[model samples]
Target: MPKKLKLILINSSILLIGIILIELCFGGWFSSSNQLSNLGIIKDAKFEFDVRNLYATKKQSITYTRDKFGLRGISTYNQPEKIKILTVGGSTTDQRYLDDSQTWQEILEKTYRDNGKEMYISNAGVDGQSTYGHLKSTEIWFPKIEKLQPEIILFYIGINDFYRVNSDAKYDDIQQMESGGFVSQIKDKSVLYNAYRKLKGIQKATKFEVGHRKINFSRTPYTQEEIVNEKLLEIYDKKNLTAFKSRVKKLIVYAKSVNATPIFITQPTLTYRIRNGVVYGTEATKYLEEKYAYNGVGYYKLLSKLNDAITEVAGKKYVINLSNEEDWNIMDFYDYYHNTPIGAKKIGEKIYQNLTELGFVK
Candidate 1:
């Protein structure tokens, strides 16, 4: 073959590869954003919004134009003075499956009105968040809530913390968890890393192999019980559980300092009923199966240990154990992590009962 011909062939091949990479990245093959947007779910919007503003510092103002998940547009902070309740949590507290009106925050507000108590509840919940996120929200937005002079602050968390304590993702510290100033600790230098991700997306889209023999698209094979138990133990032994307990204690103290009652609600999980069954699997399952293997007794044992730590720091009065005897079912969850609208309603009711007992309301 002539040298010129060989050179031309090599250049063409490189151009083809570059074109494929660009197509993969932009074609919704490499990321779920495009596909998820089509679903028109609030959770999806929240996730996409967070990703877009991951590195932003200022509050991204969002208007309530429509309900992707049945959320209602109650009076914003512009309304007349009223008793204010600030609720914080991950997806469950966020009520991903429920519309804004169906959320427990709204439910609690309506409940207050029904009983002749006038109050305004602000939903400060975010999806895919953790205890760190809750702490971040309190730090950044507590003042905004304080401007309203909120009488109570409700915190529903735990599941995300349980997952994040073991995952590889380096999210913001508690201080900046809600700030949108996200920066990955992992360096983006590996050509292979970028190429692998791009190629994976292309394979999913075109279903054609350019170089690789086969493409694998399967759920991470692992059980939920294993993942939870592993993460739970990691939090315990690494003293993360202690750190978390301390953070909760500090949050409560801070709330008291501001003259706002702080109430901690232990968010429920889907496996509440099937305590003996597995909860997760897929590629993500390998992390759990390899790290933490716990039986039913072992699982509850870890919970007891963590509960002791929390009890020691938070006292029984401030802590609301909503997971203890809740009527949870598999159908209540969209996945292994989040709860349905009805499930969140039950959780909201439990929280209301706890608030009543704590004298936050009549």
Candidate 2:
């Protein structure tokens, strides 16, 4: 090789190795904006949403309008003859991509009307909210919603809690986790670093395939670096689980005090993929799977633990498990938890069915 070319190759090799080491040591570090917390505020915002499919690769656009309450549906607060229902959750429930008529909350309203009943269901979902945010909403937004005298309050939670576990100090005190300094930022912007990560990811996928896993989609392969420590999971569960239980209790108690029945909904994600009629993969079938895997404590596991806490505290009769529905497909999801219109309608119908079966509604 020419002397200059040899030197260039050596430097590139060192850089690649260095970035991989950094990624391993500081796995969950990501660049996030403070503006991501547009929770229960920011009235009358209009959003133009667009996305292109990865496979079919077609561009799609949808316009969304938020009412004065920063929710996705009609902005009215009063209806005399209609049963008032309030839906609370994160982005999945917020659903900023769909039109007003496409939301599951709106679908539920129409479903009730078809059954000869009227419902004024309000969507109170906000982006990036967790149980902590939901609890805070009770003070910030719920009072406003309470004016409608909501006969039922629905809580959909878990995905954000699972994600915040990585960066939020409240979950595990892993303050060192967000150690993306100057070099890290550089790596994020560098084309070379991204290429290296992709190559490494492909290698991991190949290994999974060789091991008969037969699944790959834009996921980072699991290594010890990606696994959230078992001890951390235990500690996180201990602290957050208690807080989750207390928050659910508060929501339920407050709902009952107003003669409103409280229903807790478990958040679900597309965590698995099937190919050729065989089960192929696991948690976070979309983005970086390693983060959701959290070492060995999978995202679904954390969510399940939180859901279990809800069911135990709220009782089985008032809880609905939508996390592992068999009929949901990848095309129904735009991301981990946020859904396309189809998924929203599915959840809406399921909740409607449950409400009737439990006699919470006619």
Candidate 3:
């Protein structure tokens, strides 16, 4: 063997072995501690997060815990087999402000256990994510959970997708905000790297835990004329509608590919209460007039259009049209759409009822 070539091979082998050792020893500890292991994936995550919005159900600090899979909701590490159903969407689904046990997914799981059915609903929601992010999870997030194939994937969609359609807010996207790419994959697999990153995250994450989350806006009530100023009762961007349909179908196909059923839960909103021209809202919702400028009613109209598209694409058999349900009022919600604990219970119960009616859950 040539001396130079032999030296290169020996050095390469040493480097590889050292890296593997670092991963097994340091990376293993780091990933497990940071809630990024069991999938060979590292997420930019903290052990806990706190949010304090004036609209939060309680004034206390909201603790968003890191479950075993690095996602929100209860840990299924010991009982992954029982996690047959999952609810995915945006903040409404994540409900960072709500207590862990107060989320609808938790409620649903408890309800099932109460009924002698032992199905667990893994909460796979992310804040500020849209249909684009949800579809991305079909490949990135959900599939990574080893030994788990959800039987039913419930989509609490529409509201976040609504933010994307007519607006150009530079918000959350998996590529822009989440981990990916070659370097990212390598880091995700590296225990030492994960330990360094998690330490940095914990430092910054603490900043979010303190203080009151107060939303202060001019208390201006848009008149009925201003609320429904649009001449068109139905209006939506065609391109947005098309893209939304494609994503929903793709998600459905991906769920079926994993031998799981995809059920589209049409999102309910405070807009559902905008029935009268007067539109006298409660104090909690008085902010909506200021929240939606100029075309508030038109915004509701667009959300309906998107929900309709969901039904059209997924078919009526696979949809839970929450817009059609009138039993809930502003009291059920903390803000525009995010549910309170009481609201979460009602929603969980309602979903269970729908699932039973549709025979998705026994």
Candidate 4:
């Protein structure tokens, strides 16, 4: 045994012992506190902290909480017999920037309770999740929710589908990418992975964009007869629209299979506007016009087509058509699509109103 080799072995043994002790003493606490353990893994995931934790994003700041199931909003896991309404969607449904009481699901629950009806709502929204993500999540979380035996399963989805199609990504491809492989599994358990996530979080914290304030245009630029790019039609291609519709249909089928009434919503966005017959909109809207050619269609036209597909697949009775609703404006939105707390309240109220009007909820 060379003296140099002995020294190296001794130092390595000491380092390993130190790491083991640190992990044994603090790894659980660190991971649990970081709350990034299951950040991407949504199934049966729980937030690291308890109720009333303040979570601030680029748009707004609000006290956020997660149920024991990791779903946003308060946990009603113990409350059996409450008419459970599981609301699902992308970041809009997530509404993490809104306090638990201000969320539409919470507002709905409170409204029902105030009216002497027992109701519980769980939010199953994930940021950036599209129909592709929803389909997979429903597969994983549907049965778990079935145990709760929810009466109405509300889906506030659509805009993300458009975003996905526009991004030139396929649902199947996204599913595969998100489905962690062997390497991801190993990386997920690494301390370095947690550190990287924390770093990203810090970066996000520093660069938060406030709610989508109104963009003041000096004057109406495009007239009714102005010429616009023809590529806007390509935003909603038949291929992506078919995929979106198919996934939505599958969601409805899955809900019905569990005997849960499924409700589809045509998401509203600031992307729609009519100016002198010119369908001009935000940068994204203009980007579609210049980037892709789709039979000379407009951006809003593509959104309408997607909305129509949702309504066609879900049927009129079960679909909440907010696309044509006049209330959603720049004030209601925090970005191109996600809603402000006010917007969330209006949406929540609308859902409640529609549900009652349709006699889905008594």
lDDT of 4 by residue, 32-69 (tens): 43233333433334333222222223434455666445
TM-scores for every candidate against the unseen true structure:
0.58, 0.65, 0.66, 0.67
Q: Select the stronger candidate by lDDT from 1 and 4.
A: 4
Q: Report the lDDT of model 4 for residue 157.
A: 82
Q: Any idea how many clashes model 3 has?
A: 1
Clashing pairs in 2: 227-294, 227-295, 228-294, 228-295
Q: Give each model's clash number.
A: 19, 4, 1, 6
lDDT of each: 0.51, 0.61, 0.63, 0.61
Candidate 1 or 3, higher lDDT? 3
Native-to-model Cα distance after best TM-score fit, residue 228 in candidate 1, in Å: 8.3
Model 1 lDDT-worst window of ten: 208-217
User: Alpha-carbon error at 167 in model 2, in Å?
Assistant: 7.6
- Name the TM-score of candidate 2: 0.65
- Candidate 1 per-residue lDDT over residues 1-362, each given as its tens digit: 99999999999999989977865554334443332222121321332122112112243432332223222236533331353676666656655445555567767777777778777776656555556545544553344332455577777766555433443224324333323432321112223343463464354323211111111223223343433455557556675565667667767877787788777777555332433443322223222324565533344445545556666777788788765553565445444445445555666676777788877676
